[model samples]
Target: MRILHKQQHLPPLDGPRLEPHPFRAAGMPPDKSNGAPLVPVNRREHGLEARRTDMAADQRGEGAAVNTEHKDGDRQPPHGAHDAFDFRQLGKEDFEQFEALLRYAFQVSSSEMARIGWSDREMKLSKKPIFEASHVMGWFYKGRLASQVVIYPMEVNVQGEICKMGGITGVATYPEYTGRGLIHSLLAKSLEYMRDQQQIISYLCPYSIPLYRKHGWEIVSDKMTFAIKDTQLPARHPVEGQIERVDIESEDLHKVYKYFALQEHGALIRGALEWEEYWRWDSDDVMAAVYYSVDRKPLGYVIYYIENEVFSIKEMVYLNQEAKYGIWNYISAHFSMITKVEGANYTGEAMAFQLEDSEIDETIQPYGMARIVDVQRFMEFYPFQFSDPRLTLDFEVKDPIAPWNNGIFHVSWQDGEAVCEQVATCHSGHRIALDIQTLTTMLMGYKRPTYLYNNDRIDMDYHLLKTLEALIPPDKPYFSDYF
Candidate 1:
């Protein structure tokens, strides 16, 4: 069989597992498929429209930080570099201009809004939730909002350690304000704010990989889309758990995920604010089936829908192998109803190995990007396998956006805990030098030090390489949600 891999533009998470409907308050219209009935499955909004749907994300809650960080010689003169620009956090009063710029940047047309059953009144109501939940910052010239960034306070599980993660979204600048370093300052400010909030790490769905990389972000997760015929479905695996269809916003749904997120490495902690981000463009008719053990404990759940003879799996997560089998059994039971099954696997691994027939179609592509917002703080809490006596590792990180990360970060163990302190000079000790991009991916467990070393992305000796290999846990991050 011949295989072809391709890239497409997409769509926007963090929190306690919020039971509230995701983005229901963000003027999410009713079941009006906006006169476009064939709903896009899982970030289908980007696939439905033009490529690089990240611009559309600019309309929502992704964007951040301020001016202290000077990227690696990337400081460009603003329209009036010497002129004073008001860089501040946005409030409810600034909602109108904020909405205007977002709609303009994302190209959300009047007709599109009307088709989706949205009104000026409904649009106005959404401001409350957005303002309360997001740290929307902007640069205003002549009292007009031109460039902006919004960061959501969120958390993530990295090898079982919960780290506050800043979700950067909705970054945009008017053409007239281009190359003035408005974004540079705004992003710097956002990063500063994140640091204040103790958000050591940051995540964003990239509109351009190289563009974000210039700022220190790197690919941390991937989306693997698979298509399987009814004949290829695995024969139902016998299980003790029972599956039952429930409301789309079922508590069991969120609770199961809450348990899953808390334990799973690299999972997003979804609170109320994050829930809103999850269902931003989803239909209300969506359904969920939860898998409960014989004793009635939720172990897993599957959110899905059926349309046009296709069983689309919006999301399927299980806490254990049994739950995985039980969920698959539910999907196989629909064999007579669906001609094919389609879903995305975000584990950066092939699903064929687990299936009865391994000939199904699968596609893997880069999904999300992240970076160490505050390198010192991130390492301070990072769960590195401690070495004998005391574990110590130094990182000569080069951050292009946040200047604070560009230097030698001396990380060592103290009292059985990891401690990170920046040093002016690299001493004669075990040292591994790399940029912020490589460091972020390595620490996140996406790529190993040896892999990056072989790829020539790391500067390290053979002994230090082996030390890093053992210190870092081995596993790619699992992130299926798009924010």
Candidate 2:
């Protein structure tokens, strides 16, 4: 990897040439100040002594001035000189500083907190679980946290294969420190850490699509919201299974989701951390209903609540056609109790086409993005569809963040098996070209090879394009979880 010094003369890799988007928070400074209430640290990973020993080296060089590539254009440095700061992984001890940066960057107002039932007491109690579950790192100036990013060690089902994934969230920076390349350094270090830990893929919900695109992330999934009137609700479909309402933390709900996630591609396997995030903002009025077979086996569930004459569904998962009909049968029973039903679909397909009444209103928007952390490891585990004669292809990958992924990847498939390797140069004619983001989304089956080439996101010859289309399966990812 190349050092992150200013103006390093590294040759640019081959790929599409789009002008870089300036990294800025946009608009006026946040209304809140950097002073946040102190957070109580609990469940510390290491004792105070061991933590200090591990962080001592990172904190030793606080007084030295360091300059890296400013992702945006050159702006005048603060105080007529570059800021002297330290970069290190955050632990439980740094909770106060980390919380401050998040509040300042996101501008969490008192009114917003009250609406969501957030109080200072609850906020303080939330610190322990977050620190225990996430990997946090930040840039500090004079011992004060200025910028931060959090990575959740998680797993997701990718085309029936359980892949170790790094889920990135809570990224923030102070407005004054925007153009100093602080985020660039943090992102580079984050990618390197994910590679070493064997997290082959990474995903994030982007606040700015263009900003993350420059850093090697592309859209991989979408969220669809649909509304159906009481008259339009699916006509009750009879089934042997029956719906049973249960507690929000029912074990039956967990069992149903576990089976569904395992069988469904691109679904999140919820653990304790994911469950916490799932119900974090909901009120006590929310409840869950699970579909049980006549044989007493749980098959599907829906977490929902009725409010303001509207039946709102947070999530609904089903294992088979019986479960799907049984769950909807429960919702149809509520037709006399509510005016309409509103819910979201994470599967990249339209619900209108499936519903008996195809006139319901629906809208779709991009939800999450992903990037390949280690190209070699990702291709090795990837399940590419293979047929007759052997297929060989070589293409250059241009990754802006991780240098190890910025070389030519040579791949071949034969005898119902596929293998890949990265080399300094392509052995065959450069038949295709892609960036890390495009490759990730393409292989994940979110976007097909032909769509990418037609959209000018990939450069491929006529023959190579057809081969990729056949080699890749057609299954759009079904990701609905947020962080």
Candidate 3:
């Protein structure tokens, strides 16, 4: 059996145990196959040319907030009348009701709550800060909460450029209100809000991929979970660094993370709340260890915990090979107490190639999805790389969900930047065509334009398609933090 170790170009929540990893190691001997094999985009088929005509007149309402009127008297609709749902942001006073709705929607049982060490009081308290920090929106029908979604203000490193992103979470709808399009309305409203805030992109962990695809979200990242026996752990490689346990709240950790995020595409530019959420485990069981050089400069850190002879690594980040080796050495030191080590790797790199024992149990799972909220706004900030300096392209985007992204776009690279504008007229023959979802995956580096074109997701002339490939640099979006 031959093993293939593929190197790819470039958070944290216990809510589902999805975490991000570092970039894969480079310069490994390339596999001498016939050539690079074509891979299919992992998404359900949808009509790319279907434009939602109903949303055309509403394209200009991006900055307008949803009308949420408060009515007095008994808040119940009359018979045979449609429910007038008001969409509005939730406040601290609505936390109790919000918690109850979430609990009921997510089916949180008493036994499961106890197993996760969650008490009603603690859960409510812990969620207060999130509610305050997040843009929590809800739909009320007859003055009762029907559905809700939370949008978190976040920054993501997109091919070395820090772009604003809206992290979507806590999506729930009451059973009585199911199939009424309440969640869809809330999502559309959130996208409009994100556009107003200059958030070029939106990301979410989908409960159903096909369901989210209808709204324009596509898979952007994947995670590999590894379960390795103690005997399979790699031997300690020598490095000029010493490992020391550090406080979880140390400033050095954030500094290292900032440096890493800046250099690595697809990583989150974490804020204080994100960092706090990343370390939201029991401090008594979790431990933080840092690797530093002889000069005492921190280069890497690992957060891990041990329970019942099983060592679980929540996250491990390194700046250099030496730091990586040093962190592994620190983990190796605990071989006497741990029977196995299990953790998630977001880099999509093969770890068995580096291990002493080649046969370790690993599973690769698709992790998160992303969507382009405003294509015109996103292109204005896109860090396009061009070798020729002066290049131009015309393309037609088909966005049924967000009408603002539809129509012909003229892109030109000049004066060290790329400028994108909607053109009133363009030669039809010269225009390349693609839908919003396909464009989202291509820009995020999850798929290439050529791949999309070959797979029938994009339509473009041959020579112009090659040029399109050159203008967009490859990126691997690494999103670890769950909302």
Candidate 4:
């Protein structure tokens, strides 16, 4: 096939993975085909939103240390109750208790919790021991673990800027404590702790999107799923390459990934420590495959396995067209045993457009979300290049998740570089006001300020929308790893 460009030595772990878990699937609206539905905003007179209430109350009963003091009024805790609950970071000693809390809170089994860790045993975990204590925090009521959340520090690449992020997970609360707002209390404290630990951004796989949204998190990225029809495969590239199997324990793949992460935005830095944590899972269901130049230089790798007549492509990465085709040819050559190739696909290019047939079922949905905890710091560190001079745009950021982020920012640039300053008003200049969620959406390329304005998610004039769009750099931000 014709080559657009010949790039070699691509990294591993650059591609996407298999179908997400059912719980993950549940997060997406029922109509994934239509993007997010336009649900009505609650009227003040409509009383309370039941869904939010149920979700907020979901973590109540377990020995959670929920702060219930009134902001104004008597010094007593809410509901005339003041009981003692223990709070501490979980460890090996509390694995069973932690598992029990998760199962009871979420209706998941202890084994399922382990499986979520990519483990088989009930108490065994796949994470690094260094994070074991702080990653898992629990609330104990009367010596019983009631509520817990795992917070792990992650190094993520955001638009070429490597950043320290806190990934929140394993959120569980006992059912008996419903309506006590314990989870909210836990979340508030946990976020405070994250800030103290120098985590500039936080990520999570939310159980309830609305619940998290109430806490100021927004949907930023999405996972795209595709069914690769046999006929849709592209013609093999002209360059010759060889395919080989290698042990996951080898560092060859990790080295290639390191090179790949730097060239791409939104990739995770899988340092030596994190790499070990990633491969502890069983690859038994998947094949161990890699592609290299005929001269023996590694260029690509694939982790996949076939089961139930489906050749599931868990994850694959190729540095160039040759490596991509070489690896695909290996899988297709085994077509006798494979009926279909389905997986997450991202090559910084459109795969369907490259396919022999464009008409196929390819589903793309948002996967992750982020909010600018510190707008000025976020913009100062942001790498933006403007081709025009005299470009300045002001933004009114409404970050419900954190008070520090809610305000106006005057962003300006000179000599193609950019900076931001907090301002009281735009002073008749271009202006845009959007909630943090819409801002995240705009940042991720899912929606633009104009679209958000049209949908009333953002308030902006036509000129302001143009200015806003211009201020946002052109490149689409993507995350290379799932939390």
Candidate 5:
């Protein structure tokens, strides 16, 4: 790919157009003194190091000028620099450091050191000269990468509209530097960069909830966890099929997954890159197996293996009733060797009901938290009826962490359609105010809007409260994969 310095000319790629959203802490300078006035950094202009320097300075003192040199005259570490920290952009040359930082940050094994996995190669190439060095950012201290964050350009189908968005991941901070504000600086700069790029929205799988909310994000989606007990495995089979496991090198597994993706509502269309990443995990440690039909035909598949005699289902995809039954029976028959099978997703039916005795544990873990970085964009993407009568309602989105989301929105509907507009007050009707975070939670169907209102995170009039509940569709938000 050709690199361009001026933003005016560049090859087009699939990504969101970002608008700058500068962050000024309370009582912070109104002046644009945050380093070089926020230059857009991307493949066009790779000035990430300089940009970080300026932003860190601003965050440090709000008005302090950035010092381009290491502490003291020499580049030696600060005397108390063990705790004293500075931020730097991790160059491609720092892969070893990046890998080390990741290993320390996440406490995973050295499986990442393998030579030929998709994620492994991505990490390797990310540090190579040929790779396009855009979309990822990291923060370092004392010549060591302490905390890191990465944003990849992507798109998501929100409501019914496909919107350009960014998926943030690899958020890991070194053990010793957990509470030292490293993540805050990294995220502030990342958000600023995302805004400048005109990314209408951003998504991330959070390590914690309240932290990201403070920086201007709202939860937009969630995943439900389900458990199937061996006792629930029913005897009667609905469809005639045989269950078999194919060799890892066989070509039939792809066919099974391809068929599965076509039928599932929330399944991701995994390309070669995604497939490689999935299969790259250590199979011995985590059973990575696939399912096939009785007539030597591939119908359904699963990517999982037993751990500690507890059969963990990392993922299971079946296109039709036969495949689902075949796969479930195949796994359940192994009850002698396994204790249970567990996973999470948004499914129309409970896992236990399909089993023999229907005696299973239904444990739902909310996975993949999302935030609406842009409220107007989020509202615009909302699908509403266009053929009915018009009705107007008020919405008070109280987002303290990201004030831009904290405001009143007038929603009007007619002919089975809806639209939103900003409003200042509500005099003749019901009123409500919910923190943007709570609203995010409500949006994902994790909790009821009225429940949030009762908790005081949301305030609204009775009628408006009912309307808000009605406005939000009752569907469990589902994200099957992590970015």
Candidate 6:
């Protein structure tokens, strides 16, 4: 894998200093001379404090200057040297090396990369935009890139409110750096950055669930994939909309997608970049069709492709029942050319009931995991439906990874709104007790509080649990984007 470094004015390593041994406690700064702890700084706050600290150390003859090493080869530091590597944001000039590393880590062959329009030359010159420089964090050891992580700025529909979310992807570490805990340090730094940016939640498609679970991420949604023979497809039903074949790049597709995302819980509010990624098809056989009404207003769309008589539906989105039925009728019209159909649904239910045969093969798989980056901030914006009168809830939340959330929280609701605040004192009895993971899933509507209580995942009074359940609306979480 290639490694490139060209940007000037790299940020100072004001984050927690690394110890000689691997796997040191994250976010724990080195002890000061007076045996006092140093205050941690967010990304923005780091600049002033780092400069002041550097100047003070230089005056003391300590010579604590920012390392500015840039070379193409590995250069080992002297024994016992603490500042041996540089960590900074990578830019477009570094895409060559970045793509090479991604290819190796993701096992993308040259042909496969070319098939996805990621050829080295195309990626370097297209300028359509691959990723933002600030979003890519690189850990350079001895002038060679050894580890990296990408955080995609995104937003999700939490209940009916739009909440800022950070989607993490492209996390990779070279084999030689596997045991150094570089990933942990990077993640800690990323979390602090997210908190500063007001991003209260994070989501990731895990390579290993257990690995990410240790970092406070838990499963939040599931996807069901179905395979049905042509004979099993439901007969076409009359609807107000008429299906019309359209180009994949039609603007009407996004119109339908936006309407669907706003109405669906846990769906991502995609931006232009994410939309491009979602519509990027590798094969030329992909086709699109829109369900339109008599007035020519689009309400739904479907993207699919056929291969060897097997029809594959890449995506299906609709805004109403008529649009949904119209799209299904469009798909059924292809029964003459295709023998089977395959598609995915995130509602956790098989589409077999809608088919002529209810025995169609279907598989349910966990989709993605999410974590509450800042519990207090998330709860402040959470939409809680308050019933007549008023309700108050006391929560004793336990978060081992994020200490800011490990405390007693008092939440009061009135007039369809809630006010949450962290309390100094604890309340005995009559309080819901749950860890961060359980709290995350419960608030996301993945699991009801009563279910968690019955399953021994939480401790709470039955009546109080029922009240908590009533405050949270029932929602079937659905997330379509991969990253």
**Candidate 1's residue-wise lDDT over 1-483, tens digit each?**
101111111110232222332322221222222123322334211111231244334323222222212222223563567286687788878988877776666666667657556676665565457666889998888888878888977888887677778888777776666656677677778888988888888998866675576566899998889999999999878999799999867888888888777766788988876776676655655689999888787878998889898988888888777788899999999989999999878877799997868999999899888888888777767766653434566788766667788889887666756667899887737667777788999999888877887676777554455567667777678886666
lDDT per residue (tens digit) for residues 400-449 in model 2: 66889988888765555456788777776635777787898999889998
Positional deviation of residue 474's Cα in model 1 after best superposition, in angstroms: 1.1
Q: Indicate the worst ten consecutive residues by lDDT in candidate 3.
A: 63-72
Q: Which sections of candidate 2 miss by over 4 Å? A: 1-83, 387-389, 414-416
Give lDDT tens digits, candidate 6, residues 186-268.
66667777787778888887766655654567788988888988988888889876898888778887777776776677889
- Among residues 3 or more apart in sequence or in different chains, the pairs in candidate 2 whose N, CA or C atoms overlap within 3 Å are none
Compose the digit string of candidate 3's lDDT tens values, residues 284-397: 568889888777877888888889998888888887878889999989899999999998787646588888798999898888899999877677677666523445567788
Task: Assess candidate 4 and give its lDDT.
Answer: 0.59
Q: After superposition, how far is residue 341 of candidate 1 from its true place, in Å?
A: 0.4
Task: Between candidates 1 and 4, name the one with more favorable TM-score.
Answer: 1
- Best of the two (1, 3) by lDDT: 1
lDDT, each prediction: 0.72, 0.73, 0.71, 0.59, 0.53, 0.68
TM-score of each: 0.82, 0.82, 0.81, 0.75, 0.65, 0.79
Candidate 4 Cα misplacement greater than 4 A, ranges: 1-83, 86-96, 103-136, 276-283, 346-350, 387-389, 414-417
Query: Which parts of model 5 have CA positions greater than 4 angstroms off?
Result: 1-91, 111-134, 140-146, 157-161, 174-180, 196-201, 216-231, 240-269, 276-300, 306-311, 332-350, 385-389, 413-418, 423-430
**What ranking emerges by lDDT with the best candidate at the front?**
2, 1, 3, 6, 4, 5
lDDT string, candidate 4, 314-392, tens digits: 6677666677788888878767776677887643335678677887678876566665556665655555534334556
Write down the TM-score for model 1: 0.82
Off by over 4 Å in 6: 1-83, 114-118, 123-128, 387-390, 414-416
Report, for all candidates in order, the number of backbone clashes. 27, 0, 5, 16, 32, 0
Report the candidate with higher lDDT, 3 versus 6. Answer: 3
User: In terms of lDDT, which candidate is stronger, 1 or 4?
Assistant: 1
